[model samples]
Target: MGKSYYYVEVESLAGETICLQLPNDLQGAMRAYRQAHPITWENLL
Candidate 1:
């Protein structure tokens, strides 16, 4: 079985929740998520 690293939950502007399981650490997950959806950053902060 694979190790569980980090779980990231991102909600979109359209009111959809997206879930992702990241193999990297928290920092890496955040970076990847931000890169994938820069617009969501504003809502997160």
Candidate 2:
């Protein structure tokens, strides 16, 4: 099987959902998430 990844919902600055799942690591999922969805999203849900 493929490597397991974390799941979550990404929210945008306009209060809209951009996508689901960030797939970050213990070091910094938020960091990964931020890098992945830069300029489009503002928060995670």
Winning candidate number (lDDT):
1
Q: Give the TM-score (vs. native) of candidate 1.
A: 0.38
Tens digits of per-residue lDDT for model 1, 2-45: 43355668799999999877555565756666678888853653
Clashing pairs in 2: 8-21
Tell me the deviation in Å of residue 26 in model 1.
5.5
lDDT of 2 by residue, 7-42 (tens): 656688999986566534442755566679987545
Q: Which stretches of candidate 1 lie over 4 Å from their true place?
A: 23-45
lDDT, candidate 1, at 33 = 66
Worst 10 residues of 1 by lDDT: 1-10
Clashing residue pairs, candidate 1? none
TM-score of each: 0.38, 0.32
